[model samples]
Target chain A: MEYLSMLPGPTNVPNRVMRAMLAPIINHRSDDFVELYTDVVDKTQQVFQTKNDIVALSASGTGAVEASVINIVKKGDKIIIPVNGEFSGRLAELIEAQGAHVVKLQTPPGQNATFDQVKEAFDNNKDVKAFYVVHNETSTGTMVNYLDRISDLTSRNDSMYIVDSVSILGGVNLPVDKWNIDVCMTGAQKAIAAPPGISPISVSPKAKKYMIANPPPTMYFNLARYFKYYEESKHTPFTPALPLLYAYREALSIMLEEGLEHVFKRHKVCSDALYSSLSAIGLTPFAKQEDRSISIIALNYLDGLEDKIFRDTLADKFKVLVAGGFGNLKGKVFRVGCMGEVNKYHVMRTVSAISSTLAMMGYKTDAQAGLKTAEEKLKAL
Target chain B: MEYLSMLPGPTNVPNRVMRAMLAPIINHRSDDFVELYTDVVDKTQQVFQTKNDIVALSASGTGAVEASVINIVKKGDKIIIPVNGEFSGRLAELIEAQGAHVVKLQTPPGQNATFDQVKEAFDNNKDVKAFYVVHNETSTGTMVNYLDRISDLTSRNDSMYIVDSVSILGGVNLPVDKWNIDVCMTGAQKAIAAPPGISPISVSPKAKKYMIANPPPTMYFNLARYFKYYEESKHTPFTPALPLLYAYREALSIMLEEGLEHVFKRHKVCSDALYSSLSAIGLTPFAKQEDRSISIIALNYLDGLEDKIFRDTLADKFKVLVAGGFGNLKGKVFRVGCMGEVNKYHVMRTVSAISSTLAMMGYKTDAQAGLKTAEEKLKAL
Candidate 1:
């Protein structure tokens, strides 16, 4: 069956982006390859809004996340982590695997932890060496405003702040430099509209200083080795996916031409339309309006409806795919992604598809109401 | 200037394969995606010549290597790895990261670790858990005949045999079942003619028994988690690159249609012709004849000339890109690849390009003689 991807990642890669990704692969050591790689690094810097060394590694985003945890936190060191989403909780698990201790602050799904809670945890844990948080929680469409609060906490405690902007880097503005974020890493699959392989990690001077003091836990993820490899030869520690690197350079150029502000605005508009349409059909959003994600919308499914059935129906009947709630809110909420190449037309079509599919499934809802509401919202934009 | 890839993966992706790679990205949870992933896994099993659990990962081959080492070896387990090529040496480094001791066996470049040397080391290190080796050493173009020797060694000793066929899987015969290999892994970009992301790794029942006895290393590369994730969900440990996965299915289908024996024969023919042409130009091959790679040919530059100039000339004047010597052989040897779509015509064209380009650079070489000899070799095919 023909399918439309509205999942968080492996998001809809535009045809142009896919063509760019399919460009002929080049030899990594060649002069032409060096030029291409250097340009890609620069483009990533422009998008990241940071001048820190943006080292790209040939692995999944989880690999980079492990690198962040393994590099900064040494054995027996204390780390502060949040357990609100699956990804964040997984971060803590990785840290524990390194033989480090993680003190986690637990919160319910779709609920944002306040700065006070983080500060209290920091104040209570005197041996903490680093604090990690996810900027945008993909499991639940909740946005955490850590950039504004993390600097104060880290400055007061003299600890490193590792921010994960994997799903929100290009779709939203989280200036790494201005926020005093010690280390920020992102994946290419989500907002960059590129096939996943390379994850760009920017290490602040502070983070490098931390690495200098503490040895890296994993040899492959060592920042010192990365610096030597990239700074000396503009190559990775291992053989990189050359075609994916070329495709990223092309994807970054397209992002720059579109402008980050335009990208942010597009995401916001689509998300707002989705929220308005869902609410008009008598469904509530899982996240608070103020904390809702501009890249994704989490909908609270109506009473007596199982989410697996709903998600399957959307895929089987409407050919539109959406993510069901994971972890805590499984079968309670549905997530539709509006990030990267998701336009107003695509939003309207999705709303139409979902509304009709819901009606066919005998869910009590006004099918016309959602589409009308989405179109009206798009028209206002 | 248009660049050509001659390095071992990511190799030059053909237009047909690239177009297949450019296919639309689908939602990871969609049935279409599951079907695509299942097809890719099934096709990969066919290539690996095994009914074992063939799983695909969304990372580079090194990550797969890391996964294999970390999943199978416990904290204090002993590993015996050949230090023949750069990649096999990397296996030692990865084993060390897990706090395991590596019983290293020295095998210099342009040579393979003799079965006697490995067996002696295994005999000495009675507590050794696994013997790690690279099937095709792309660094030196030396292919080890491990299948015949390792089967006997593993039967005699209490150790598993893990093979890295990253550069040789499709181009060479690696009958995993017949070889009784415990763990074997390969990447797609080399001979599979697809972009790199997905790495196919198969673990035999013997390997699983060892893993169950040992503790899990890291969460990210946990084989138990990977098996559970795929067996239960039919997806990966994470969101995989949908387009690349689909392209791999297509590439595998093409490979199966061509037949494995025919594929290996074509690679052998091209490599022999290219090696003969290089020898005719007064360049000695880097790898020993007894253990030479059928897909990749390693040749030393003539009489102590800088290898960079000849490599640059070939890329600039002829647009025929060949890999430079890696690791210790850098600037001493040039590597000509004969894998993936490289046939008799490719060998002739590459020989003509290399001989003519070198002749123009004042190297006392006969361009016509090399091409004529290479043409005769191709006609014999």
Candidate 2:
């Protein structure tokens, strides 16, 4: 049986999207593929609310982040990253792995970095080449605010601003061009509602210029080569995963059909409902107030409750698949993804399932409390 | 209309494979995905004919090639590469991009690198860290012979032996263990008959050890990380392309059920039939007779015919897809891929289509002559 994949990525695939993926694979250089790429890239830019260039890469979201970093800066360059969640830590590691020096704007999980905190990193690093941030911290369900402020500071300096919006691109309002982001990328499996193995990355003129001057010699994730090929042949330098592009096209159609503002508001309604439901069941979210993500909801296990056993109960008994925290947050909280096709029904079921599971484990909780709260919030939608 | 994708890499995916690809995508870190990955990796080894570690990367074949290079050696290291085809040229460039010194055993297209030539390069550049070869050079349809001899030479020294069998791994006989190949990678779209996203790479213990020590800073194509993740958790370090893995498992099952020996023999039979039919049509293959590939057939265009227009006529009129050459060989010849589900019927149809297209284009050709030859060769199969 196919479980409902409520993880941050590789979520449930809609029937139309799956059918789209069933189309026979096409040659990457074929006219059909180029049209597909061009159309998808064009639609992707509209969803991103940007007129900048976007590249569709055939790899995981982490690979897109690597492409951004490696293409922009090389060894000995300094990059400042805000390290709050697992993905942010990954960016920092990837930056250092490229032989670049990294200065961390450290923040606790579920917390946002103020503009002054980012400035502190820049002040200490002085001559920083780039600033990396995770727009939505999937690890703790913290959607960081003050990105515009951070972008303003980075723009004043010569540092390029890169954001990993992997878990919350379409569902969140991160107007890439307006925020002055040098590069922003997200994978298909998350809010885009497509399968994994493909990620779309948008690049500002600033980042494109940086790539042209100092290109990485990578055979894959070579954005400069990709840009050149798209300019010349309107295709990727390497073979793209054709099937995923079809699915992405269908997903983007769904997004555009729903309209961007309506999609964001849908996420907001579901997120608010989930937050209220969890609170009604006496569960506190891991994220700080106003920093909680519409993409995911991370809730800490009540004192004396076993997190793993609770999650396993949800998966095994109710067949509700949720994710556990990573790194420092492991075994302390569970993460429920509300990205992509998640809606009021899924939110209500999730909250109800959690409440019932807690009560099944002998915890003091009202049986219909979470569900009632969710219904009240979702009634208007 | 979904035209046949008969290109070397993105061949027509079978119906069963397409159906398998329709499965709901699961979380990459879920128990289901781990099981799927383990099962697929084990079966992939059977098709690869090796007991070595196999990594399933979410990028194209070129990404896998880069992973092999970055994992094995870094800057200032010496390596020897054979530049007989377009792919080998790519290998040389990748080596330089990694800041390594490349010693080239150069040969023109349609030619195979001699063992003597490789030895000469290694002798001149002593203590070479690695030796790179393309088992099936997709560019000119040349499948190099005497790899065991070349592997023996590389073995005599401590040079790591890496092979790019992107176009011909399952169809051609490349015994990884017996041949002492450190790493051999192939794309899913080729002989495996899966979609284009994932590439299976078999790595020997020697290569794994080398990778552990000289790890590439790559986020996506880190084979060492993949190895560790598989060992500890039986999954990829990053999000894997789930749907492709399902289809790949089905594809592998198809090959194994048919038997590897039979699969290889089928490819041989098809290759022989195509060669005879092409000969009957007065088309000279680009590759040397003995160096011809079982997976693809590349033929030099007749002196006066435009290869591009001929290819377009085939696509527009007959709905047949064949590729042309790249780099120096561009516009020189056209390539027909006969891997995966391609068989004697497809070959007959292709040869007939080519002859018919040539005839329509005012060339003197017997359209039925090629079909007659193909049928005779395919009768025994």
Q: Against the true two-chain complex, what DockQ does each candidate achieve?
A: 0.54, 0.80
- Deviation in Å, model 1, residue A5 alpha carbon: 2.7
**Fraction of native contacts (fnat) of each candidate:** 0.51, 0.94
Candidate 1 lDDT over B188-278, as tens digits, reads 8888877777777999987876665664535556677767767777866766656677777888888899998888787777777888887
Error of 1 at A211 (Å): 3.3
lDDT, model 2: 0.85
> Where is model 2 chain B poorest over a 10-residue stretch in terms of lDDT?
B1-10
lDDT of 2 at B37: 87
Tens digits of per-residue lDDT for model 2, A1-381? 456667777677788988998776777777877889999999999998899999989988988988888898689998888888888888889889889988887888888787777787777766888888888988889887777777767867778888888889998788988988889999899998898888899999888988988888777888889899999989889888888889998999999999998888888888899888888889889989878888888988899888778988988888788888877988898888888888876887788778889989999987577788899998757
Query: Candidate 2 - CAPRI tier?
Result: high
Off by over 4 Å in 1: A1-3, A212-220, A367-372, B1-5, B212-217
RMSD of each candidate? 2.3, 1.6
How many residue pairs in model 1 have overlapping backbones?
A: 0
- My TM-score estimates for the predictions, one after another, are 0.95, 0.97
User: Deviation in angstroms for A207 in model 1?
Assistant: 1.3
Positional deviation of B86 in candidate 1, in angstroms? Answer: 2.2
Q: Per-residue lDDT tens digits of candidate 1, residues A1-381?
A: 557778787677666766776566777676766898889889998998889888887666777787787777667888888777788778878888778888988888778778889889988987688888988888888888657768787888888889988887788887888888888988888888887767889999878867757755345567777777777788877656666777777778888999988887777778889989888877899887666777768888888888888888887888788998876878888898878777888888788888877787787777678888888888754
